[model samples]
Target: MIPIPRTLGLTPEQVDDLLTTADRAPSRHDNRPWRFHVTSRVIELYSVPERALPVADPDGREQRMACGAALFNLRLALHGHHVRPTVTFFPDRSRPGLLAVIRHGGTREPTPEQTRLLLAIPAQRFDRRPSGATAVPRNEQHGLRRAALDEGAWLHVVHDRPERALLRTLVLRAERLQTADPAFRAELATWSARSGGVPDCLPAGADGQESIEEEPLMALLTSHLTGTVAEIQVGQALQRVLLTATAAGLATTLLRQVVEVPHTREELRRLFSAARPPQAVLRIGWPGAGTPRHGGDVMTTATVP
Candidate 1:
């Protein structure tokens, strides 16, 4: 463990709390392919390739996206502690494993926006409705899109009836391919199936079902380019959008089934943007009365560097 220092007004207990919050970010097949190297002054995030789902995520886009989400939580936690964090994505060209280097800067009080967004972190859940779709207020939808832009990513809302129809067809086909693959289903089942009190995987009760109901505001998050660094930025944008939506009393779930397939992803790229690469698609709407928030953490794969 890295010795927790009193710098930046953060106590050891606060640092531990930050780590706990970051560990809850979602991942592919619940394989949290992220590790942290922390010190009093800095926190570094890295990807653990061993934890990746090669067949389902052959290009490792989801892997980097997972690390990006973790990085966002770390920054938010530090911000809440009144510590200014200087972040550099892909700071070291020589060390590709080091996705980000977040240095703790001077102490200052968090802004109202920061506080509200931070509060929404724990409420962001993988919501799945058995039937029917709920609608979100138009203003709230704009706020969610703004959150992504602030993080240097794009959220393309698919609303046209024709586009929604195309998306449904593409998602159904991709999901069929994934569900038919023995290895993919085996891996998903292994991580998602919980027997004890373990909470490292997807919610224990979730039946890994794709939503075939009427579409709500389906948005795709895209980056300027499709690369390792770009994917990390996309992840940060994704979390920001999801948290902002949750703060606005909306339930959000990632639509990975559509974007996981390479060919389908190409189709999405053409639909959303020919220039930018789509990293994730999110389903946004009003949740049921008292929908449960998602919360989980992974076993520490590596520690302080």
Candidate 2:
């Protein structure tokens, strides 16, 4: 295990890099809702309440998941600095918005994997229409699964045919369900209209990509617990998985809506036999342009190493 330092301080360059890396996290509709507060003591993670998407993410589950991704990036940025960070999740029980507090720990050299992952941060993104026909190698899939375990989550690759069929049906149902709602479309369009995806906008033809029929290797990231703590870990697991995939020459996008609707989510959970509901579902494959919608199940799902 990496040791943690008691106190932490950051130079202007480190702080800038840290915040920059944190900002690169993928948010729903590209509405990045995470913020960072830096002190000589520790760095705190915050959620921008005003950035909440009501119609789609009514309870702020995805929003917090985005914040968790931001938090994971920040942790990696610190790791790049060669110092273990001691993190306090939901540091202030009274303040739910404060997601995590990270303090510098022991001095340790960054691992080769950590170094490579940090560099891949800028290249990592939600590739909507990535070419999924090409398969991901077994080694990389294991690494992706391990990344989730390294953090506090499980990566379940959807493999059963019945489950895959159910997932596709449920995903399509979610798209129709969301499309039928006028408010959902308006909100989605509003985000899409934003200039250059500024402030907020539908990313990579949002809603459109969700309908992609091609099923990729679907990896479901689930937390051991429920509520804030689990969601936060889910985000971290997500980034780790994404970065690992990116590093392995694989591309990804979130299969969000399937897990968004309550009934569909329960069905997805039952499909995987997951003890707790998953935080996010990932569609992974070779990188390509014209991204697809929250892509489908693990067509060639592999067990974690």
| Cand. 2 Cα-lDDT | 0.72
By summed lDDT, which 10 consecutive residues of candidate 2 come out lowest? 296-305
lDDT string, candidate 1, 165-273, tens digits: 7777777777778788998877666655632223322121234224433546777888877678888888888878877876776666666767788888888788755
Q: Provide the TM-score for each candidate, comma-separated.
A: 0.84, 0.84
lDDT of 2 at 295: 30
| Tens digit of per-residue lDDT, candidate 2, span 1-305 | 33232336667666787888888877776678888877668888899998888888888888888898888888788899887888888879898788889887888888998898787777654445545576667787889889999988999887666666677777777767777889988877776665244323112234434424454576788998899778878888888888787767676667667777777788878877889987777777775544432233212111110
Provide the clashing-pair count of each candidate structure.
Answer: 0, 15
Give the Cα RMSD of candidate 1.
5.5
